[model samples]
Target: MKNVFIFTVIGLLFLSCKPEEKRTDYIINGDASGVYNGVRAYLKEKDRTGRERIVDTAVVVNEKFTFTGKVDIPKPSVISINSVNGNLNFMLENSVIDISIDKANISQSQVSGSASQTDFDAYNQGYAKLKKESVDLQNELRNIHRQLSSGSSEQLQSKKDSLTDLFTAIRQKEQDYPLNFTRTNTDSYYSLVIIEREINKKNANIKDYQEAFNNLNSELQSSAAGLYIKANLTTLMVAFEAKSRVDIGKIAPNFEAPTPEGKTVSLNDIKGKVTIIDFWAAWCGPCRRENPNVVNIYNKYHSQGLEIIGVSLDGTRSQKDPKQAWVNAIEQDKLSWTQVSNLSYFLDPVAQLYNIQAIPAVFILDAEGKIAAKNLRGNALEAKVKELLAL
Candidate 1:
């Protein structure tokens, strides 16, 4: 009985002493020849606010540095070393990684240990080919455009045809590559990563992004990349809707904001007339110069059922108050129109609704509030107004 009890107690002690299973932790150790001895390394992951969250930091020790952390799953993080030698942006996954960074040949640096990194290597190799071809085609198109002014009529037509083909091929390939890859690799989490990266391109179409997103695996849809896509996808949809509204033959999206006199004015207030939706900011020198042209057009066309609705992008700043500036500019420029603003600058809700990319933008709306034209400046603005009024 004594031996039996002793054995039982020993077994219990052994059981209690056993180490728990190790969590998913990563150790990134690497050497860079050109880095300063005490240079800091920042490990970062992007957050929803379009900013990076510093996961950790390590200082170079004895020409080597190490970082240790636990990752619930694979994450796309960057090891950024900003030093006197230059900046090194090394992309890595959250796994035990051995980095071999060549300062002189940084692009050719080798990173091993993570399966996802291996996949990244392969993806970039293929992507490089397509990007190279796209760049070459773009260069050729630019050179062709430079010759447009002096080209013979037939030559110009031929150049135009070539330019169209090259441009179309480039866009189609960029769009199709992600769509085809995501559709073929539905279960691949990295597929969502690639789509997330590509969908942020300025030329990305909403339909393509949606199709690719839907094709992703359900598990991937719950991943970090998927969440990033979901957030940006919402922004893209808003921009897409706004873009469509400003296109010719589409009705304008109505908005209401406060005028300089604290009176609220809405786009619908100026309906039943040919109205110009002018997007301008008080700080824009060109916008101030262009104000006279707009004034002239309004004066000449105001009698013929022409109306103007100016949307000022001006907002207050710490150094200067934009409301006073906006009011001053209006009075000085003699802009006699129904103007409104929320004073939020680019973040102005109305500007975002119309997808206003730059100042001095205008959408000429017809009598029924459908966009008849856009970006009609100087004589073009006057001519379009005249033509619309005649109709």
Candidate 2:
């Protein structure tokens, strides 16, 4: 009997030492009240290319549905119902989350049980207020613009100016909110998401994003989003440096390329009292549309010491006879200025020197070949050229 008791004790101790199973899967219990049976709910997420793709699907039976999945980290997901106009957005994590769906208004649906979702909700709530204010300001500005279109009066102009100032202030606030949220909510995983988004914006301040990432707690800094931002910072830093190299007041980088007639021409060769380095492409609709204005500007000011070097980004591997297309566009658009191209599209060496990401990019230079202004269009371009030429 003593031996039996000792063996039983040993077995109990062994059972006690066994490890508990870790829960890695998430289960979503959804209550689509007032919705008819057999409706499908799609779980959606964005792929690396920013395309929305379905991750899972479940059908509502008796106004109830369930979704089961595993995610390495919290992900922003959407639950879209069949025949519904809007989506129910939530942060999907490995937890049992309960969602009470409002079929008539999916965005207003209630969610609980995921800490990440709670934080996401808080962030949205703050952002929505600013968004509403921006919308209101935009509406007012549109109304004033409509009035100005009919006729211009000093009072209407004054009101338009006042509304423009308000709109600008609200927009600045909207841009600052996400960064401010990251600073105050460093512990929240959503902060890392915000930082990643800010890092991707055009002309994003890398210094500010770096500071915000550093302020995050160690755990968040080690998360998937944080690591992505860290890894891409080096590339982004390089791009930022390139931008600084061509900034206004910096000497425009000089390069030579083949002209339409097969002669090599450099910026220094065509340098004048005022020079306009116009980056354009054959297939770009916007560049084509803006060409007339450029031609007009050249005709008006070329005799007044204004020089234009049209750097054509007019070739792609997919294009048949890229040089033919470049020559055709120049003749078709009536671009009379000295035109040059390597016929390599965006891969053209001169485009890379100017850091041209989009077509219709313009760099206006002073007599000394320093970039005086950039990206000016229409009246702004004409005005700057006129001022620089002392016309």
Candidate 3:
């Protein structure tokens, strides 16, 4: 009888200690209720599909909202709100939360909490500080450009030196923050990655600015930001094999390929004049579309020592069309400049030499055959060539 009673007591304790899994719901009351109702929400789940859908909600007033759904309390999920204005994000982690964001910056803004005032204020403070700093830097850069055009040699040098010192100080602060956070084991991996990328970009821009200011030539100096942005993008591209990010003015690696007439051409052959080598395949839509722009630039600047060499990555497909796909596209597109291809597709010698992982790659060489620019496309290409050739 005593043994039976002990077993009964154990059973009751086990039932009482079982984990609780209850269905719960919360209303995410907010300002601009109609704005939330008018917007659609896409819920994203990593490593899963078919979990996304448009959110249907009812708005009560200008600054009130009701989110009705069955949710498990204490679990986290990301809700992405999309509207005509833009996207807003929220993290649902608690049983109840009230979020209020300024309507003006809603597109780029986000907030998260579950009835907590402390976390909201902390997040907003960091966001506001970052935005202010970004704006101030942009304004300073604009003023520097205006002053650059009018400054004498001595004045330019002095200004350049001062800017360099300022950038160095900023970099030092950036490095210290990373190191300090790393020691604390509190820095998130993604946050560290973002910080590293930003620091590298900032340092690169600073270096480019120093070079431009030192050059003194109006044209060369004017293209600094454009060049910096392009070089940084190209460095990130798969074609460049850039282990470390490349800076502007660095010499591109030498490459070779066969001309359309079955003659081998080397970079050395085009050393004396400015040459723009166009790397494209016949199958690429963007490549075909951009051909006309290339032709126009060539026509306008060819006489001014502008040499464009077309390196086709097509062989079989380009030969199949009525005009022969690539050749037809070229002629149809009115590409009358110099053309060459080994018919090797991606394996083309020139493509491999320049690490051509993508179609529509371009390299512009100066009079001395050093790399002047890379990846100048669309309006940027026209603007750059006009400046370089002084058209």
Candidate 4:
């Protein structure tokens, strides 16, 4: 009896001491009282490629809907109902989240239980006010510009300038809001989202944004959004350094590629007193259309010390023979300047060196090989070439 009693006590202690299983799944209990019964509700989120995909679906029964799922991390998601004009946006985490859906005004829907959603809500509440002010200012600016388009008198011009100033001020605020929010809400997952956006901007200051990202809590920094930013930051840094190397007043990066006749030519070998490094591809319609203008500029300026090196990005996988297409395009367009290509499409090393994202890219270099101007086409191209040649 004593031994049995001891075993019973041990069993009870073991049951009491065992750790509870941690919940990894989310249960979204939604109250859609105002929505019609039997309507379908969709839980949607952006995939890695930024495409909105439906993650789960549920049917409203008795004006209520429920969703059960698991997420590795907090994700920005939306809950949409059939016949609803817009979706209810929230941060979806692995927890029991209760949402009171407002059928008429989806934006007014209330969400509870997800901490990340609370941070997102707080950010949006402040952002919405600034957004509204910006919209109002933009409307006023548009009205002024419309009036000016008819005929710009001094008075109208003054009004337009004032409105422009105000519009610019509001825009600066809008741009700064995310950074400010991130600074104060370092623990919020939304901060990582904002940092990702800031990193993706064309002219993003990598240093400042990198500092902001580093300031985030260790857990937030290791999240999906943070990891994405970290990877893209490295890419952006490479492009940024490339851009700096080719900026106006900076020496153009030198490169060599195969000429149409199967001869390799380097930029240093072809550069002249006034050089035009024209990046184009045979398959690019805009580049083809712009060829005539470039040809005209070359013909007029070639004898006067203007030299052009046509770098073709033509070897896409679709083309059977990228080299033949490039050669054919040159002949078809009457491009008489020195032409070169690797027949490797956008993967051309020269194109990568110059940070060429699109075709019809032009970089005009002055006497000493410094970039004088960029992407100047039509009349602007001719004028810059004339200026560089002192004609």
Which number leads on lDDT?
2
Judged by whole-model lDDT over C-alpha atoms, candidate 4 comes out at 0.89
lDDT per prediction? Answer: 0.79, 0.89, 0.57, 0.89
Q: State the displacement of the C-alpha of residue 318, model 2, in Å, after optimal TM-score superposition.
A: 14
User: Residue 319 of model 2: what lDDT?
Assistant: 80
How good is model 3 by TM-score?
Answer: 0.42
* Residue-level lDDT tens digits of model 3 in 1-391: 9999999999999999998763366556555543544554443322112244444444345445556565432222344444435445444433556655455666444444453223334444555655565556556656776777786477666766676666556555554443333233221222222222443553343333233233333432234333443365445443223412222465656666665556777666654356788888678788888988888888877887788888888865445542256667677778886677777788777777776778888888777666778888988988877777766
Better of 1 and 3 by lDDT: 1
Candidate 3 — which residues are off by over 4 angstroms?
A: 1-168, 175-247, 271-273, 315-324
The collision pairs in model 4 are: 315-345
Which run of 10 residues does model 2 get worst, by summed lDDT? 44-53
Root mean square deviation (Cα) for candidate 4: 6.8
Please give me the total number of clashing residue pairs in predicted model 1.
Answer: 0
Backbone-clash count (model 4)? 1
Best by TM-score: 4
lDDT of 3 at 271: 46
Ten residues in a row with the worst lDDT in model 1? 84-93
RMSD of 2: 7.5
* lDDT tens readout by residue for model 2, 281-306: 88889989999999999998899899
- lDDT of candidate 3 at residue 78, scale 0 to 100: 40
Candidate 4 positional error at 217, Å:
2.2
